[model samples]
Target: MNTLNNHENTNILDLPNEMLFAIMNKLSKINVLYSLVDVNRQFDQLIIDSFYIHDLDLTRKSLSGDISPIDKQTLDRIICGKILPRINDKVNKLTVEPLSIERIFHAVDYAQLYSLSLVNFSQEILLRHIIDNAVIHRLMTEQITCLNIQVSDKIRSDFSVKNHSNILSLILFIRENLNDLTFSHWFIGLGLTFFMYKLSSTSCVSSTLTKLSIFVNTFDDCLFLLDRRLESLSTLIINIVQIFDTSANIDNTKLPQLKCFSLASYQRTCSYDSRIVPLLRRMPNIEELTLFLSVIRMESTYIDGIHLHDEILIHVPRLDKLLFSITTILYNINAKIELPSNDDIQRGFIEKEIYQADSYVINDPSK
Candidate 1:
């Protein structure tokens, strides 16, 4: 019996550090590292040496208020010591939940990390901590690459002018970073000042951005901002809450590098500003275009003076594919209309021979 037990212990010790590291990486929570530290001296050393502890989720559950004091202390030590020291170089993704700006700043300041995701954050939280924190601003300049800022309607309802200024400051800071940015929010009540401020701030670093998405409540605000001359931008996605015409002052020639564009709008009050067709006229390099209309009325005009079909033929001559999602109109003044099938648009465009014969595939195969 003694000989058999000795052989089993020897086998366990023979396991390679790589295998041990893999096992630790599979843990769902970083705190689990503490548990493994107590398993054996070998595990403790292995966990300390592994660098794959880069994905961090700081939701409330992860930082449970019920955590024992000792555990909290231990976590603080690990974060301030090992984690923070390697933060700027090792961490690639980070998700933070709704918390005080102070706590958020504390986590971000020490991390000096990139790829930040903010969830359930309001304008107040952003203004208080992130905008006010100089250290956070400095860290963003050096390390951040991907950023996601999402705000709900309720949050917008509570936004004030001061809050708008705070947001502008944050945008200015981000523009300096010139990273991939995603802004998801309803800018319904916010005045034109917000758009002007944002555009002026972002224009400073438009040359560095590769991906940009704006979810706006009104196309008017977006069009006003897009009117400014952009230096560099490759991918663009716009989800508008209301239909509005693009500004005539827009300099389309500046968007020569654009490769992808998507516009989604609702149909009930759906109306396309004729300026869009002309704007599309300038994006000759766009390979993929998706236009989605939510509602349709029976009497609604199918072809406005914009000549969407004609513009596509002239400007985007090398277009690969066009996607159209439109609702059916049951009646215009009581006249019934059938919804056009998506495939119908595809077939119609193909029959017209509008797409380039050897253009790049619309749907990325690798994705």
Candidate 2:
């Protein structure tokens, strides 16, 4: 029998160099620099090698999209004081909010910057940076290849009336060469979803945007986008409130290049129909799929948890992996999942597994 007290305690700092570096990779670089830097010459040298200092998030953020106020003293020490000259050349991805966007540009020339993240920015700042000032335009067109943007104080109830032309223009601008894009907001309304699909209405489809994470408000929004500029989308993540029934058969449309899809539903109190069946029919080539959905088992009508796998396993032509996270409202119970094999499309063999949990990550064979 193994004893609980038999283990030895090892100090993190005393670990091997490789182990130390691995641990450092998991931690926030901002915290690492603030806490561990300048403590010793060895530490400084290790952190300065473009790995820890390459990606920087100058602004503080959280899931709610509220940005922490910038401290002038801290900014002075980080930018004008010591950081610019030390890691300017090494920095490749720099995230800045509207307040410090101009200041950071003036302080350093991140010649190597390939990715840029704009976080917690107001609509006014977005317009100024991209339109009035043209600072963001120049950086985006010339240097950046990947962009992640989170709008500020996203709508909780209402959106103030404003011209959305600038917002549309900025999104179109990024479509030029941006390979990966994440545009998210904390809004609980359908405005953001409408805006996302509106971008696809343009004459030109994005040939470069391969991966995207965005909100989908309705069945129309989903079908409209899947039929438009998102044709080249390979990896997609959808945050949808609900999928409704359509009078017309939607099987004609397809996400031809899509290989990986992740879906999450927000309307928790209501149980949905097997709407994903038609969706999988269109995505015939999907290799991996992940679902984060809430199951509402009301007393009047109870949906068998097996419904999750019943359709997908029988419909989708090819699927290699599946990840699921399901939440229940009335009662909590294990789900019986039916997973298809890697070659199930050809071999025609279906496998059944009883999974007892709220989440699971299942993989294929040939390991």
Winning model by TM-score: 2
Candidate 1 residues lying further than 4 Å off, grouped into runs, are 1-52, 60-88, 98-112, 152-162, 173-175, 186-207, 244-254, 266-269, 273-276, 295-314, 321-324, 328-367
Residues 1-367 of candidate 1: C-alpha lDDT, one tens digit per residue: 9999988778654878778666656664455544554477776556544265566554434335321122355446654444445443455676655543344346535453678766655567665546566865665667677777765334243245446545644664565655577766444455222343244444433446677787655655555445433446677788766664444454555456778888887635434435455567777788888777644334443431133566464677666767655443323454444434445544555666544322111222242
* TM-score versus the correct structure, for each prediction: 0.64, 0.73
> Which pairs clash inside model 1?
267-295, 330-336, 331-335
Residue 271 of model 1 has an lDDT of 42
> What's the CA RMSD for each of the models?
8.5, 8.7
Question: lDDT for every model?
Answer: 0.55, 0.64
RMSD (CA, angstroms), candidate 1: 8.5
Worst 10 residues of 1 by lDDT: 356-365
Kindly report which residue stretches of model 2 are placed more than 4 angstroms away from their true locations once superposed. Answer: 1-28, 31-40, 61-66, 154-169, 188-200, 246-251, 269-274, 295-310, 326-367
